[model samples]
Target: MAAMPPMDDELKALQWRAWHRGTREADLMIGGFFDAHREQWGSQERDWFSGLLQEQDVDIMAWAIGAAEPPARFQGPMMQAMQRLDYLKAPK
Candidate 1:
């Protein structure tokens, strides 16, 4: 049997969804972003990220890749932070 991942409930839930987003690209973008930043996020940032999780993976990818503009409500520091894509690793 496989060992379970260690995490608190909130973080476990977020990480699960982040890595399981419909596409590998979405997973890398969202999951990598979460891994890079989760340690430093505050309550409001967590809430905002939770809201972002409700969006479709395609839309999220589009926004992150600049293929489409994020909706007005999603346009702000957090979205801008996502747009940076600094968390994505370079291919080896």
Candidate 2:
């Protein structure tokens, strides 16, 4: 049998804080992306999402987060937006 990885207080605290930090970072990035772009997508987007608001939001954001590539139809625009965002985020 393989040896199990040892657990410790330091490791647990590190992971707990890291998990929250990561959650905060993801919320900031993805939530900001939604606040920044959801309005700009137009009625076409609204209509498309009209029935599936829950999934649509997550799907679009997952694309922006690099969690998964957007489908072909979404690739061009989201990629363009992501590029612009990347530029805006670059150090002066």
Candidate 3:
């Protein structure tokens, strides 16, 4: 996909909002992403994910929401993160 316009502080604002609001949507997206890739992540990875700052997860989830575009260098990790987000938000 074409790179999005450089976001400057727009992305950061979104991340901050999600974190302050404690958006369940953000948690679900981040949790689902990690859950879907459970096998790929070793125990340490899982621990790291669990220990991540809520703002960090909010930032990643913000990217998946397309509320912010991730940096081009982060595409691969963002893609993986999105996959997990999709699974978590999928219809039960």
Candidate 4:
């Protein structure tokens, strides 16, 4: 296969991170979110997701599911969308 462009390469890395979070639940939540929304993301959204991927899976999950409050930086439309949890799909 041909190599991806630089931006595509970066997105692929982010996608890998989202889908390989060391647990089925986290993979589904984070990866599903990525798959559902990535096509529309501009640089700002991608940067937000990149920062989020650096955080612990438990903290990300907790913030997404309302188990704990997110930091001020993470409190915004993106987190709100994650909490909605409408994007997750079961693997076939």
- TM agreement with the true structure for every prediction: 0.86, 0.37, 0.45, 0.88
The better candidate by lDDT, 2 or 3, is: 3
Q: Is 1 or 2 the stronger prediction by TM-score?
A: 1
State the local distance difference test value for candidate 4.
0.92
Please list the C-alpha lDDT of all candidates, in the order they appear: 0.87, 0.47, 0.52, 0.92
Give the winner by TM-score.
Answer: 4
- Per-structure clash totals for the candidates: 0, 0, 1, 0
Off by over 4 Å in 2: 1-22, 47-62, 65-68, 86-92
In terms of lDDT, the poorest run of 10 residues in model 2 is: 46-55
- Candidate 1 residue runs with Cα over 4 Å from true position: 1-7
Candidate 2 residue-wise lDDT at 9: 53
- How do the residues 1-92 of candidate 3 rate in per-residue lDDT, one tens digit apiece? 56434433533343344334456776566545543555455555544444443346656666676777665644565355664445665556
Candidate order, lDDT descending:
4, 1, 3, 2
Candidate 3: the clashing residue pairs are 33-84
Error of 2 at 85 (Å): 3.0
Alpha carbon lDDT of residue 76, candidate 4? 96
As for candidate 2, its clashing pairs are: none
lDDT per residue, candidate 4, 1-92, as tens digits?
Answer: 56533448889999999999999999999999998788778999999999999999999999999999999989899999999999987568
Instruction: Residues 1-92, candidate 2: write the lDDT tens digits.
Output: 56545545543433343233235544444444444555355556444333222344456457666788666655565555653555223236
Model 3 backbone overlap count: 1
| Candidate 4 local lDDT, residue 19 | 98
